[model samples]
Target: MKPLQTWVPVPENSDFTIYNLPFGIFSVAGDAPRAGIAIGDQIIDLAVLADAGLIAPEKDYFTQPTLNRFIGLGKKVTNEVRLQVQRLLIDEDSELKKNPRFLVPQSEATMHLPIKIGDYTDFYSSLEHATNVGKMFRDPENALLPNWKHIPVGYHGRASSVVVSGTPIHRPKGQVMPKGAASPVFKPTGRLDFELEMAFVVGRNSDLGESVPVSRAEEYIFGMVLFNDWSARDIQKWEYVPLGPFLGKSFASSMSPWIVTMEALEPFRVKGPDQDPEVLPYLRTEGPKNYDIDLSVGIRPQNGEEEVLCRSNFKYMYWNMAQQLAHHTINGCNICVGDVMASGTISGKDETSYGSMLELSWGGQKTIDLKNGATRTFIEDNDTITMRGSAKKGDVSIGFGEVSGKILPAK
Candidate 1:
């Protein structure tokens, strides 16, 4: 099949190809943020088109500051709008093409958080990541917890702390127990790290006491984004005992501005890793559940060039999104629109493919050599971490552009 063609001049290697019309919120100089779609190097201001009666004429969801309203319209309307936008972009004679005012250069636009995330959940879905961490902190012979294979372990995260790409985060301050110390000390974290992840946004809300089944999980998900779940390793180790992550995680989390819809990723769908011991009937999925998204993480020093630290893939995850969602709501927990659920630390089998500094550096026991002759066991102040992801198959290629954050000294 021929890839979709747009009138815009998209570079062959650009992530925003005609086949991928990812959505985001953008604001030009002196303008308020509004919904927009990426096309090549330009952003089609959906608000402009909607105001001009070119699309979604019956509704004004595009005028909103975030994508929550538009996504809440459900997949039928959202998918229709996506298809119509594709048609309009491909049709040279279409009014949208003739009206240049509706298009804005991406360089001139400032991106914002695409959605108003009401709740956030981060899941430990990567087997290798889990094993690595377990071996470091627990018994090497029994690296994986017994319940890991049967269920997707996750914890609710701070939605308010989730920021958009380019947002600088302060190094989190928390209580930490130094090696061989009896009590903990409260101070800025010395072991800040980044967790390379991908998150899906929920489009439809479920009533309280209602559960979303695995079979129809895709229908509820709007799209995905590259996520960086910043971690305070020392703080986490000292506090993560009876319960899960808290202040060690809640300080900050970052995500890319754009959301790549599931439709754009359909071509890259693949079967997930085999579930040994067989998952529960509720967690079983019939069709392809994993996506073949190439993922990588890069770290740039305060004054040095970016160094690619890790290369991994979304397919490395043992538990897929569908299973995670099903397990999340199995106990009659309701989900809301704009909820963000992240795939925790997508590490592969190889050591270099480890997702976090703890795993990649082996809990700070080893140093990762960088280009500037600097070595790092954990993230340093003023260092920036960026994560990128893309799915390419045949002529179709789409991507979750990237999410990056520069670390600042704690106040």
Candidate 2:
């Protein structure tokens, strides 16, 4: 497909190209947060466009602070708006090009969480990530649990603690069991880590007791974002026995500001890893279920330069989003429009492809040498971790710009 030319001057390798119109919520110095779409280095204020009678004039969804209302309008309206915005951007003679008030420079705007998340679920979908963690903590021969191959394993996450990019996270203090110790001690996390993952936002709601089959699962998906599932290894190790993650995970999780629509990513879809021992009927999906998005993680020490730590891909996931959603609602569990579901810790076969510090450093048994002569087994105080993702084919590319967070001392 040929690149869509626009009247705006988008850089050659820009992530926000004409082919991509990712959405977010942004506010100027004194203005309230409103819906906006990224274009090159500028953000098109959707609220202003709506007020000017360009798109969705009769509806007030575009003027809202969160994309939840806009997304709730369903795919038909959202897709039409997207196509109209694309046409307005590319047409040189359009009136939108003459008005500069609706365009805001990205540097002058503060981005907020794009949606009001009603619930969040994180799925253990990557075979390599699950297998690596299992080998470290459990027997290598039985790395995967007996039920892992049959179902999409997931845990309910705290939606209230989910923050947007650039939010600072304090090290969580929790009980930790030391080596050969009879009792655990309460202290700040000694093993702080970040998980590289991607999440999809739900656009349509499902009623209780009504199951959404695999065939209709994609229709409910709104978009995708980069997710960082921060972890405290010691806290999780001590607490996770019968019930899954709690305080160790509930403290905080970060997501990228912009939500790249599934329509924008349709061109980059690819086949995911083959599932062995075959999944059940409900989890079965056809066509390219996974997107070929390249992911990377970087760490910057207090006063040091950023060093790229790991490289992974979304295609490595053993269970795709469709399967995850289908399994989620199969048991009559209801879902809301702004619900967020994540693909947990995407890792590959090699050491450099590991997503989290626990896997990359081999459960703190090894040290990762930094460029400034500093080494680390896990994240340190004042260190910033950034996660980035992009999907490209030929001349067109779209990205979920970096989701970064700095660690502060425990409060």
Candidate 3:
């Protein structure tokens, strides 16, 4: 199919094309945040469109600060709304082309967290990333734990600290055991890291005792976003022996403002890596469950040029989103509309494609030489980390914009 042509002039390089109408929350001046769709370099204000009687919902879902309420209306309503907006963009004689109030320049709009995430889960799904970390920390021969091939390993994460892109995160102070030391010392994290990832937003709610089947897992998903799961390696290393991460990861996680819908990414679906051991019946899924998205990570030193740290892809995951969601609710754990589930550290087979400093620096044994003449084993204060992702197949392209966070000195 040809890319949807619109009267609205789209820059060739812009991520928002007529075919990719990602949604978000944005505000201008002192106005309250409202739902909007990204197209080219402009944000089509859904609230304005709703007010103009272009696309109406039963409730004022478009005027809300988060997309959760609008999404809770179900995919049938939300998808129709997106299709209506798409039609308006392509129709040359439509009122949208003549109206200036319905559109806002993206530069002027303050993007907010698209969803009010009620709960967050970070999954260790990437095969290469899991293997690399296991080799580094665990025995080389026995990298994967026993249950890795059977289930999608994940930990419930702190949702309150999750922030939108451009939020600054302070280095976390926590206990770390020094080399040749008997006890751990509390200090600002010396080995700060960033995990390049993609996360899906849950759209539908489930009952407390009902389990969502693997085949129907996609029904619960709304869209995807670039997620940067910030980490303090030292703190995690010391505390993650019996239990998982706490202060190290709970400090902050950043998310892209725009949410590229699952429907938009349908064209880019591809087969995921084959599981060695067959998954349980509840976790079994068919079809191309994974998406072929290009992902990259970059770091910009304070007052320096941004250098690409690594290049990876989402298809490297050992477990797909369907399996993750299936396993998550298999035990009858209910999920809410704004719940977030992240694919942790999407690393590839090569060292250049490693997702975190822990892998690229070989557990701080080597320093990553930067283009700005600075070297890094771990993130330093004032250094900014940015993650970008996109899916393309011929003329159709979908983008997740970017999630960026600058590290600040610990208070």
TM-score of each: 0.99, 0.99, 0.99
What are the clash counts of all predictions, listed in order?
0, 0, 0
Candidate 2 residue lDDT tens string, 138-247: 98989989899899999999999999999999999999999999999999999999999999999999999989999999999999999999999999999988899988
Pairs with backbone N, CA or C atoms under 3 Å apart (clashes), candidate 3: none
TM-score attained by model 2 = 0.99
Q: Specify the poorest-scoring 10-residue window by lDDT in model 1.
A: 54-63
lDDT for 279 (candidate 3)? 83
Candidate 1 residues 248-293, lDDT tens each? 9999999999999999889899988899989989999887899999
lDDT of 1 at 235: 92
Which of candidates 1 and 3 is the stronger one according to lDDT? 3
lDDT of each: 0.92, 0.92, 0.93
Cα RMSD, each candidate: 0.9, 0.9, 0.8
How would you encode candidate 3's per-residue C-alpha lDDT over 1-411 as one tens digit per residue? 566798888898678988889999999998999999999999999988998889968438988889999999899988899999999999999999999999999999999999999999999998898888889999899998888888899999999999999999999999999999998898999999999999999999999988999999999999999999999999999999799888889999999999999888999899998887888889888899999999999999999999899999998889999999999998899999999999999999899899999999999999999987889999999999999988788888778889999999999
Whole-model lDDT, candidate 1? Answer: 0.92
